[model samples]
Every structure is written in structure tokens, then in C-alpha cells.
Target: MAATPALEIAPEKVAHVIIKAREYGAKVGAWNASTEEGDADEDPSAILEDFASDPTLGEIAGFIDALNDDEQANLVALAWIGRGTFEPEEFDEAVDTARSEQGNSTASYLLGLPLLSDYLEEGLEKLGFSANDVESDVL
Candidate 1:
């Protein structure tokens, strides 16, 4: 099934976020596995230190912040659907709840989820939006 155009947040935008989240997860995994003795060419501590100052988290935060309140709420609702807290048919209710409970910082709230990428992807699928094209383009 095709994605409903009624969706407030575009599928393309969601795809972008998913890609960034995946990239961030990869960087985190690499940072976790790195060691001083691992690779001579790459400094583990330096890499980890660089990550601390990197704009990855900030970029995501900024992207999310740029969205309108309704868009942000929809994003959160989709994520909740993906996370299994709400079903696809309950999308409206999810969005309503997200809007009602929305805090000041949507970015902080979203970035805190470790499995954000997976959840977003799942949510998109449930919404009848396939991320395959977006994923390929990202690669």
C-alpha cells in the first residue's frame, strides 16, 4: 500500500532522520569497540574524543527542531507506532497523545532512544511508506 498523503510529516523527511540515526548508531558502535591496541592508523581515544565534540547529535536535534509542532508530534507518534506502543490504525490517537504530552525539546526526547533508527523504519513500514528507495539513495 502507498503511504497516505494525509500524513503531516513527509516520508522523505522521516527517511532522512532514520539514516542519520543509523549513522550515529554506527559511530557509537565503533567508538565502543575501539581500543588503543586495535589500529595504529586510528586513535581510539581521539576518535571517541572527536565524537564528543561532533555535531551529529546537534544536527539531528536541529533537524527535528526545524519541524513544526504538528510535524514533531507526528514524528513522535510514528516512532511510538514503530516501538509497538501503538498500532498503525491508532496513528491519530498516537499523534494526539504526543501533542498533548510534547515537551519543549523533541530532539532530546528522540535522541535518547537507542533504537531510534529501527523504530523509525518500522513506523514508516506500518504507515505504508517503504524506506528502500530512501535507504538506497542515502547509501
Candidate 2:
């Protein structure tokens, strides 16, 4: 069966979602960088287990250490929306924009948002990395 059309998310919500995305990414990097031995694309989960139990955690720290101010902001917004941290109506607007622009619903587009380290972590999770741990230290 064909999929039903998704409701649009708003600009305000989109903005917030982007921030979360950045945060998630940054946290993952941070976790990885904290380790004595850095993780790579291949089998990074093993090292993550030793470092923070959550593989994506490294990317958060990594983001803070590596990304510039603007890039950081963008990623955070991605996570915010991904996790539903936006006003209902606003989120709808953004989703609508995303659908028209990216040919997919806002949530899906957020997941696939370019330049998001968190998005990369999502892929890692698919590879068996855990993205459950939340870093209270992260702002």
C-alpha cells in the first residue's frame, strides 16, 4: 500500500529539532574523544562499550571539540525535533517545508539532515551502537 502523506512540522519546531540533532552528535563525539584510544568507522562499538556503554556518546564530545559554533547549533536543532521537542503546530510547519523541499516528511528529513553528526550516530545505532545514554553534563 502507498504511504499516507505526513503532516508538516513548523519552522519553530524545526529550529528546535536541529539543536537536539547537534547535541546528539556532539555528545557522541565527546564520548569517543574521552577515550585514550579514539574510535573509527570500523567496529567502534567495542571501544564505545569500554568508554561509555553508549557508542553514540562519543560523537557528542567529538562535536563540541571539532565543530564550529554555527555547525554546533544546526546539529542541536536536528536532535530537538527528532526527539519531539517542539510546539505541535510549529513542528507541523517545518515538516511541511521539509516534505516540499526534501521529498520526505519532516521527521524523516531530520533523520537524513545533512551535516548532522547525530544523524551519523543514528546510522551507527543501526550497526548495534546504543544511543540511549543521556549526558547530563551536556548543555
Candidate 3:
């Protein structure tokens, strides 16, 4: 394995983002018309419903938006690495690209990715950080 490069973004911060991203991704569209008749009190699965008012989305976006420019760029680079757009050894290049290509809000860009949680987790692992360990600590 290659030596893991140091990260401008902290692993714990990434872990928190991963946890929130998973929560947001796990949400399903609102109950179908047929299932809408089901009693909400009895349907434990209601928690999975993606209501427009769900706070998870906003929380994650806000969190990402709060990161410094370098951290945000590194976060995007990490995702690119995990998504196989770049190898772990190409970390610097990925970061450079992320920095250069950033047009919209980092939060918006990252939140748009359907596999954000998985990518971040894989990125952390590729960088030789234990996602589980960091997540455990955060939890």
C-alpha cells in the first residue's frame, strides 16, 4: 500500500458528513398514494419517508458549506478518488482539479451525488483512515 497522504480535512469531520449523508440518502420519496391511507401511527417505516421538511438535508448542506475552501476542495477530491475518477496516489491532482472546477456551492455539488456516503467512506479507507473507527468515535 502507498503511504497515506495527510488530509486538510479532518477524518472526524468526514465521518460526520458520511453519517449525515447516509441518513439523507436512506430517505425514500413520500408514501405512495395507495400507502397514504395507512395509519401513520402504526407504520414504523414512516421514518424513512423523505418529507420536504426533513432537516437532514439542510443540516448536511449547512455543514458542508461551513468548511474552509481547502477542506471543501479536499472533500471533493476524496470523493473523486473513491469514485475511481482518480487514484489515491493522484490525491494532489484531484485536489487541484476540485479547486479549479468549483463553480457552485461545494455543499450543493457534494449533496447532488447519490453515492456521497459510500464515496466518502471508500475515500477515507483508501487514504488509510478507518471510517468505522472515526464514525464510532463521532457516534
TM-score of each: 0.80, 0.27, 0.91
- Return the clash pairs for model 1, or none: none
Candidate 2 runs further than 4 Å off: 1-48, 51-60, 87-139
Expressed as tens digits, the lDDT of each residue in 40-98 for candidate 2 is 56655533233445544344344343544333343333344444453323433434443
The clash tally of candidate 2 reads 54
- Which prediction has the highest lDDT against the true structure? 3
lDDT of 1 by residue, 32-133 (tens): 435422342565444433244567778888999999998999899989999999988888889999999986698889888999999989988888777787
Error in Å for residue 86 of model 2: 1.7
Using TM-score, give the best candidate's number: 3
